[model samples]
Target: MGIRPLAKARTSFAATFGGLPSGFWWLWTAQLINRACGFVMPLLAFYITEELDRSAAFAGTVVAGIGVGSLVAGPFGGALGDRFGHKPTLVAALGATAASMIALAYARSPWALIVGAFVVGVTNNATRPAHNALIADVIPGKDQVRAYSLNFWAINVGYSIAMLSVGLVSFTGYTALFWLNGATTLIGAVMIATRVPGRARPAEPTEAEEAAGGFGAVLRDRSFVAFVGAQFLVLTILLQSESGLPIAMSLDGFSPSTFGQVAALNGIVIVAVQLPLTRLYKRFPESWVLAGSSATVGIGYSVLLLGDSAWIYGVSIVVWTLGEIGNTPTSFALVARISPDHLRGRYQGLYQVAWTGSAVVAPLVGGWVIHTWGAGPLWIGCLVVALAAAVAQLGIGTRLTRRVATKDPEEQPEPAKSAPASDAG
Candidate 1:
């Protein structure tokens, strides 16, 4: 009976993951490698303060520059993908990211590091829209959620490994982290450039599609624009895990290794529950799921106001990580659903802007809050912002759901082999 149950679980897992294209798997593999080797960004605050003896405020500025780069990269790369091809955009971004990482590693002065960080941020984030667009292009709409969910799972698994390794590697010095990050990124780029099929141009948009595919059309999407705003607010809160949380721990006398341990909890929790939760979350409406996720994030961060220990931090991480797991793939899937086939790259680019823009905002504000009122106030602010975003998302999500149901009836998604018919997003 136990063996039967185990076999049934295996069958269920296979059913859930089966029927994705070879291209998506290749992209997935590359993303996993890129994320595992993505070690530099999270440690930047420490490197600036501990290694270079810089101020937290200065570190915030440098981090803000990363967001600025990402802000430009989102639309630019998406345009490139739409015009030239997703493969070329992805390859170019990855290769540029590798070079920038090396440049950033060698940079010693404040001005040099800031410039390098901006360049690195551009090259690194330029991959997002193109990568997402390609997935949408190749995968059927029905499977996109599952594909994204699996990809998100792979990302966290890699993140877990990377965060866990940060402690051991930091004792050696930050230089190695940059070098390994560059090497692996370059390898992933090469793999994609060689393995993935390259197209000189995407299929030409129809007359109507051409008219609808411009940035103006994307801007005219009132629901999408509002969604982006709500997303921006939620991201401002969630991204603090990367930007503010570590800085707070450091201010509290925590070492880099200690910070790494606590940070790793985010990825660890995601790794354990993302897929199972994906299955569960699909049973609920996206509006409720996303709104609830934001509220959950607010509640999680509020845990910090009650205590000041690593255990408390760990507990906070576990709660917020659950929100992150729910939000990330669902948000991506929603963006894909809202976009037209020909304008996918453009729509995805603007969506990327919301995230990158928030990355810019979160650190500056978080640093100020921490520096002025301390960590308690910062977390309190997160709670308030997150709850507000939740309310906004619920309303927006409900509207979008109605729009998606009525608007895209012509779309005939490919049939799955044995997968459940539920909308996984």
Candidate 2:
């Protein structure tokens, strides 16, 4: 291409992706690698029912174990990141999770599987707080939204790889899938340990922070706490797509392979459109963006109640994919708006806790509700929760802005000292 053409392209790229640190890109690369190898979760239900001869309820319980691990670990992990350093916590979480994935691959007994699941959950998701905090530490405020958007985009791209490949791998056996996931997890761990310096720990908290007391302080922030509750409800509704939707497809006589194709639609759409959508949401209030997203997600799931055809499912996927595109980056930016830099990890963890808890409860609740009551009621309940959360989000904007306005001047939102070079996809 001509030099002028190349120059134009680079300019466009920079506009879409605000300058973020090289460290953020390294973290993004690690996320891409790790999620690309994630094979077990999406097909876990099928594995349990077909290979292990277990009920959907059993599968739900196993999956719920992951949530239990994350629930316990998230905030604590965040605290560790703040106290000890983000890098070490990330390395340890990845290592432990790698071991858990291997154990899960080999386990045959229910108890073994459940224990494995719990360990995987604990180790697997514990990195979230540290990882998120590190991003905040590295990236500038002006670019935080795009930075998070790109990160979320990379994740779905990895999921697209997993979704497209895992079903094909199933014929060779799940043992291969589990081992591959472990290998990648370990690789991602090594990447961060060596490439991202985790040597710098935060200085001791100021007297105010010391008195407020970490988790106690995070809990007492009423606006943030309310936002967490809203997020928790929305997540409980949306996570059903991951846990229950595939199972319902299976029960309807769709093979795992077929279901994989249909389910991949979500990731495909995300990979295609999330960046453009991210740009669009940047123009609106985070609150309105979030509320609209929650409602759209509910509408997407409710569509599932209408029919089971490939086309119907495809339409539903598009609706919710748009919601997913908006919810995550906006939520991260919102969190940053109200959080003190020193307490960012704890705040991220509290946010992590909200959604991770949904993963724990949604599957078990969704599975049983689906098992006893049927898919229709489950969809209805999901829609109801989604709408309620949407309403709650509208209130969040008011509270979040109020808190932002009243925080200590030094604690208030400020532009990053400077931004990194912008880049497009």
Once superposed on the true structure, which residue ranges of model 1 sit more than 4 Å away at CA? 43-64, 105-113, 166-179, 197-200, 247-258, 370-377, 407-425
Q: Candidate 1 on 1-425: residue-level lDDT in tens? A: 69999998998787567777887888889999989878888788888888889899999888878877889998888888887788888888899999999888788888998999999888888899988887777776667667788889888888777766788564768888888899999998888887666565677788987877778888999989999998898898998987789888888899988987887788778877788888777766677778989999988999999888999999999999899888888889878878876677788899998888887788888888998899999898889989999999988887776566566644433323343334312
- Of the candidates shown, which would achieve the greatest TM-score relative to the real structure? 1
lDDT of 2 at 233: 85
Alpha-carbon TM-score of each model against the true structure: 0.85, 0.83
Best by lDDT: 1
| lDDT, candidate 2, 16-99, per-residue tens | 764666777888999999989888777777788888899999998887787688788888788888777777888888998888
For model 1, what is the alpha-carbon lDDT of residue 230?
89
lDDT of 1: 0.83
Q: Assess each prediction's global lDDT (C-alpha) against the native.
A: 0.83, 0.79
Clashing residue pairs for model 2: 13-423, 13-424, 14-422, 14-423, 19-420
Which residues of candidate 2, in runs, are more than 4 Å off?
Answer: 1-10, 42-62, 103-113, 167-177, 197-199, 243-258, 304-309, 364-381, 402-425
